[model samples]
Target: MALTLRHGVFMAPFHALEEDPTMCIHRDLELCEWLDRLGFDEAWIGEHHSAGFETIASPELFIAHAAAITQRLRFGTGVVSLPYHNPLMVANRLIQLDHQTRGRVMFGAGPGLLASDAMMLGIDPSTQRDRMLQALDVILRLFRGEVVTETTEWYTLVNARAHLLPYTRPHPEVSVASAVSPSGGRAAGRYDLSMLCVAAADGAAFDALAANWEIACRIAAEHGRSMDPARLRIVAPMHIAETREQARENVRFGFRKYIDYFNNNSPGRFPVPAGTDPVDWFVEKKLGVVGTPDDAIAMIERLQGQQGEFGVFLQQTHDWADWEGTKRSYELYARYVMPHFRGTNAARVASYQWVGENNVEFSGKRQAAVEAMFRKHEAEMARSGGGS
Candidate 1:
């Protein structure tokens, strides 16, 4: 059976240091509007305070702004670093966004991604995961209308309850970020939340994808909660054009700066050996697609073969290409790649085949009808001449 899949961008909006930050943000908003026009299902905006490149400080604020300009594209806080904010505030902010967007919001929780982000807040890196779990528990309880009063080493929640219930039933859809570690899977299972495989492009992460999902399913079973594959999202990087060469050429505009950001600033280092052509290295490693729509389709099929089925495939947004080229890349994906996976063209394909298969018989009948009309005209002319 063909599966219904949703497509979107995971915009940890990577901009070069040379670019103006103000213009970069506006372009990011424009990208969301572009996506909405192209019929994208959603956009997951990142929240980062430190990494300069991934510049959105507040995903919720960005979502509010983006949502107002667009009509139907849903938004997720690619993740709100749960350990960074108070649980009450996190729950309240999302609930308000839920109502504000009329339920076009999703709550994606994670242990903070950047060590520098944690360091700035005086949070111990080692305790971040545990803190995320604890904070999430409180948030979920509050969402359920439970007045939660809990004390923990990091913080204490006293008689806390959300004044406004979520516009979404039960609550806005909740998801947790999963990379190489099992912590995300464990948390997702325990809480029955969706899983966002953020590092699905990494080799180790790709290898562990199925196992982590199994862990989620096993834990869910133990808790009497079943995990839905429809809620599982796998994210990877991609940039496509009319041809593979053109795609590679497009990335040359800003790929080096993106590579620099990852190799130096990000904790999850991208190991591109010196003297290796970054484009060749990236594609050879199967880290992402820097090719045409066919390449993107193949990559998605490869992922499906490895992990079975999933809900969404979020393109890891990058400044690999120039603005126009970048927009074209997404346009190509929307025009060709999406329909291949979505089976959107199935009916049209079937209709064309049906016409082709019956053309001989239909043509013969059409010719016969024309000949009969000609015969009728000649007979009427003869009868009128005889009467005259």
Candidate 2:
């Protein structure tokens, strides 16, 4: 089995749109609908509690809404911070969500980065590793329809049983968010789960992350299990257009707003390490992909070659308020970039080699389109009496 490249949504208010908190939820839903119509495979929302710029603290709640509106797109939490809440409750919610979405749900969990978030919840940042592991174990058990009766230092659940079972057999796919950490990758491999990495500003950073994933996969193999690169997902900011200059302009416009907000509000939150300017970091890291369709395709090819088979490329459109820019980018991507990567059997087969062992599955809409196209061809052939 080979993994195919699957398109996904990274629901976040990354640029100027972060300023208007209200737009965060609305924009994400709007994007979800757009992606659904555009034939994307997955829609992933993130969770961040009390981050000044992010309002998606309750990803499940938002994703539930997205699931309701869309008929086929798979919904995922880009990541839910696992250490901040009770795992039992989270597990129950996931079970409910899986049912609500009729098994089209993926769970991505992580130990959060922000100290402010951890402090607000009385979670010790230092103990996050242990807490995360404990929480993951608990959730996994609960999702498997087992009774979990346990008391951990951070949480207590006495004979907890999920009222609803996940729609996916066993459970929906589980992913771990790994950024600048081997721990997350290793943990994912140990549990036979998927790994999703966010490479902040550098291709090398992405390479490093991929190396860690490979190591994790090897470790899993040693344990009589295997890790599939096709199951690995990456999140990045993407802006595509017909011309490189146009794409650059669109990104620059969005970047200006993002830079202004960070400087004014959380000055040096993403501090330049000694001599590097933030802008340079952004370019070198490949945090934002702004280029012609061909250029964007080349970058994706480089990533696939270096990173191994990736299951999903979750693109975060800078922000929705910049509707024209976002629309242009996505339209170009759909018309030029996406088609190159989708539908064809050769493309699908190549995707597995580039992405990993899992076969890329189409969402219902895409499946229908493909079926209809075949039917049309069949009908035309019949009308011509099977003429060549």
Worst 10 residues of 2 by lDDT: 355-364
List model 1 lDDT by residue over 127-149, tens digit each.
99999999999999999999998
Give the per-residue lDDT of model 2 (tens digit) for 159-208: 89887888899999998878776777778878989887755334456658
The true-versus-predicted C-alpha distance at residue 173 of model 2, in Å, is 0.8
lDDT of 2: 0.75
Compare the candidates by TM-score and give the number of the best one: 1
lDDT of each: 0.93, 0.75
